[model samples]
Target: MLREYYKFLGNRLIDWSQTIAIQAGDRYVLNFENDDQVRQFMSVLSEFNGIHNFYLMTERSGPNALAFDIDPDSHMQLVVVSTVEVTPDYLVNLRNRIGQQQGVWENTALLFVSNKVLDSINSGAKDIGRQGGPFNTGALKRNVQATVDKSEKLSKDDKDVLKFMVKTIYDGEQELTLMDFADVYGIIEKGELSDSDYIQMGYFQDQDLATYSSKEERLAENHADYVNISLAHGFGDVRSRITKIVDGEKLISDLSGNNWQSVNYKQILAGKERLKQNKKISLVYDAEIMQGINEDMLIWDHPKGTSKAGQRTRYIIVFNDKHQNKLTVKFPFDATVQDKWITQSKINHKHYTVGTHKNQLVVDFSDLKTNEPESVKVRYRHHDIGSLGFTFNILILPFTDNKILGLRPYYRVKVKGEKKANLEIPSDMDELILGSGIQSNKLNVDKTSQLDNLMLGPNDQLKADLSQLSLDDDNESFTVTLGSVPLNFNVFDNDDNKIQPRVL
Candidate 1:
């Protein structure tokens, strides 16, 4: 019976096309035909020398025949031959039970007749194999493909780590240090070098620089060659600025316009390092140009509007010095006295006092660091009546030099209540009537003379005489310019309804 069992577990099963192969670190169950087949399997298992953690059951509903571990220490491979046609559900339960055994078994094989059992076993194992499994060329290829498919939705940093891991695995490296893992994974602990530090150190070898004779020439050549590479791997903010410099959209100089030179690769590298160290400060603000104003000045709005008080706008200002600098925001002299201004720093929770200095409302920011952005929220209410607008200035005073850096012009205008009216010019009518209902006929305007004299010079101003028309609650007047001609008319709304006129 033992000889028959040995043959059934080996060449006999192979010849009969009943052999089963299983990967290590997985579980399987063998279903026998009857008690006789189970007894034969037991006899074969007993003949094995090093099969440890053996468990034998008398009578059970499922796979209760025998269980044992087979690994290097056991000096044997486990094989179970059975002829019984078991259900897929029963085989799954048996597999789970075997997996719960005390010790892990290596190289387990199951021979059974049911196609359902075969299907269940194939679907039960995870596509990715467990760690420390016996390596097979086909399995390795499948695992690598599986890893690639799984990495589709991973983040860029995670994909980077996976790339390093894949390269290491492909190179068959057996050992890895913690520092190596940290570097690949981009984990900057207390003592480790930052990503910027690694980039600044330069990855090119000395052998790569053998062509250059002088040190300055070598550095210049290296900088030129490394620009593209560093731009590709640099930090997010650094990449954008470097791109702007490369595209000639921005200058590569300090705020004071000093160190003005063509784009240098070393300067960009140093900038990346400085960014990492929080040596640069950025101030974000929102500004827009007035529609009617022809000047190129942008009107700066309050940091937060009345409706969107929670939203923030970011502005950037780069400095040349490494030490902390004081920035003073000066408001218009009239606006300082007529407006109630409240200022707060969003980043460091620092309190800013709006005080008058040199006939202007000035808010000073001292000891500003670059580690985190310092955003100041300015909320103000204008109390003055008939106020036009005002211009504010941002001046940065660096301790290293007496030069003051004037960033930009920050102008703000008072909110006004006004309505837009559109007028239509008729081809046949020499005079047009303006107003609502029967009262509309009271005001009439002739545009033939105005149209003839519409020629305007650069500093010319065309004004209409409206001294005879009394504009009160009963009458309203507005002027519409056609080409360059100004036509004035009065409108009366009997029902006090607002009118929107459009030019046809």
Candidate 2:
């Protein structure tokens, strides 16, 4: 019976076609067919000289077994061995169980398997084995593809990390650390690096440099156009000098003027006609394509960065067809007496009155003249903005001479605490038509536009606009709906390690 058991164990190691005669004091055999059998064999082996040294073996036929030397490194006169057929699930479970008490058997990489197993694995194919011995490309591809595909369902930062991972894997990289992987796969060309790669690299270090580089590359691609416009804040109240210039009226006295009457009437008529021009401005922001912030994050604030104060600046840059003499501007929120305004000379004219209708700032430029550049600057304190960041939305309520040439919003932001504020400019700034700006700005301070401080204050702003201008809208004030971008975050640490925050 002992010899029969020995043969059974040997058969697990060798093919059933092969035979071996059991010799006394030479090879001892044990049966391990299931979890109970494995435990029983371990118990018996532990009793005799201890199962100190063992080598694991695998087979394609679904049998896994172990061979042991009671006294390894010594000339052992007795060898203990066992084998059993196991399904894929069983082998996985067995490995996990062994790992649980692997103190003595850890770091053992030596594995021996039957020629049939090797042949079956290859089916006589030599490419995968030759390129990298025993690598399962199919398994690798599926594992990697699954990870990347799943990441698409996550926030933008995760997709960036996965993009870097996918790019590395596609290059047959052994690791995600670019430095280490570069040694094996060779350095990547600057031109070949994707936007995602730069973003992922930024999280690990030199984020400003990464951001600048990504922006440069994007510009080079010519996939879209970009613009930057700087809007400043004024310290005093809205200019109150009041006057209404009607048809053929003049603000400047023309004592030496020649035929000023006809010129004044033409200007007024032309301005009215320009305001009547038809304009088309659709929201250029695509919530599906644009990346957003992730909610959960572990912040490593810059030494000079501060915590938790938030404020938003909305920019409205309008260009009419050099026609109208005055354009009325309205604020969605009430401008407290404390709020300051820095705008164009005409829009800030003494005639402009900052009134409260429905508790919001309403500026009427009745005496305003046509085709002068203008913007609104409202500086106020804000709170309750979560870590993900804030959003600025523009909804066009139909109004007259409402031809929106092009909108290039330069976002100005002030975080809770910090010495100097930062600016977040989008690479793509197109114009928005009725009720919508062509582009939506997502001011997430974690990935593409992170600042030194945890919260933003007055100085953080968007300072650029697209060059193209001119969309015509004949509708009255308050006719359109505005849309914002998707929201969430994906972040990482300095060692190029992906950071996944724990949710409470």
Candidate 3:
């Protein structure tokens, strides 16, 4: 028998294992094989040495047992000495739940375990030691990038912060205060240096810089291409008036006198073709790999026409920025709208949700039934859109590796509480596509062109043109089936640190 925080045995103790966790202040029963060590512990605790709340537990289901609750946050520390030989019944728990205060942290925790317990844990190859935070590669990388990006020009404080970040990346334990960094950069003084002197300057403003981390989320929404065309004539008043007055069919003959006829027609035709091609191509966005978003996702249907000839299509999603990781179809929910349009899924399937919300770009494959269908039902709920006048628009384009790199995403964001433009930040990884490092496929581009010409919707101009000539004597209604699902995304409340990412 020996004094230990965890109990020895009972009908319930058989489930105890060496790696199991035990919370403090839990009542446990300690069954004794011998009584001497128990008496010694009692004598040591009985000295009235301010052990205020000790209860002698005797409600054992068997003959010999001892049990009690150890008060948590107890100012006094209790040392449990073991005296029993190793037996199958004898067990020790490794995961002791200790209280930790937020923001403030304690290091140098002491864990005492019997050699037998260590041996058991080693046999299972389970190490009880693991740490979190500041060590996640992507998190740390984004944090570092944010810190570095904030300073277009570095202040002494910024430089010091940079040095601290490098040190922490390679080393295990590193701690530095603002003063320590300031001193290293020679911003410290011994003479009449006053804190209020540079209080409004860069150093003072960057005090909370260490805590500033970019929301490294892939944007949830897909990107739409924006095109603006301008037509102007700079000829004499008579020529300009004539150019403006040119009628549609007569305009060609009217402008033929000038050299602008063929060139303008070519440009107009090109623009029209480009516009048509742009509409057929589309992008779907997802998040980074191994960031705890979606675990495994696949392109269920390659963008292709149902025709026997498998015409492929090329497409791309432009990100707000470029990134290193693979753009996984699986992305975290809240991160789906972080202004990053980098990660995207190509939409070749007939029925799919493709578009961006305020912070989310969603491509839903849930309601898809067959591969033959063409037009998809798009639905959404946007955030803070009315006041700021944010409307959902889409841009479809041919996918290529170059498109991923050229992705420059922007949004018209208006702030709350003020009737002016609000804070603007660069798109996140999901804001745009990085490199389409995936093997190039010409299929995506070809398929887009082929489908755009297919005339997908019922009664749509395109559909009407492509509709087969009906020869039936009786009128039969043509029915088109559309798939839809409720698209719901909870607004990410920054005030609450509880961030939940959903994988679709």
Leading candidate by lDDT: 1
lDDT of every model, 2 decimals: 0.34, 0.28, 0.27
Q: For residues 169-272, could you state the per-residue lDDT of candidate 2 as single tens digits? A: 45553433212222111112121333333323221112232344243342222111100000001212111110112111131122013322222222333333
Most accurate candidate by TM-score: 1
Q: Model 1: runs farther than 4 Å from truth? A: 1-75, 78-479, 482-504
- Clash pairs, candidate 1, are 283-315, 284-314, 284-315
lDDT of 2: 0.28
Candidate 1: deviation at residue 335, Å? 26
> Which of candidates 1 and 3 is the stronger one according to TM-score?
1
Which parts of model 2 are misplaced by more than 4 Å? 1-311, 318-324, 333-348, 380-504
Q: Model 1 compared with the native: what TM-score?
A: 0.19
lDDT (tens digit, per residue) of candidate 1 on 93-174: 5565445542433344332322123666655543211232222233443354344434444444434433433443345535
C-alpha RMSD between model 3 and the true structure:
30.8
C-alpha lDDT (0 to 100) for residue 149 of candidate 1: 36
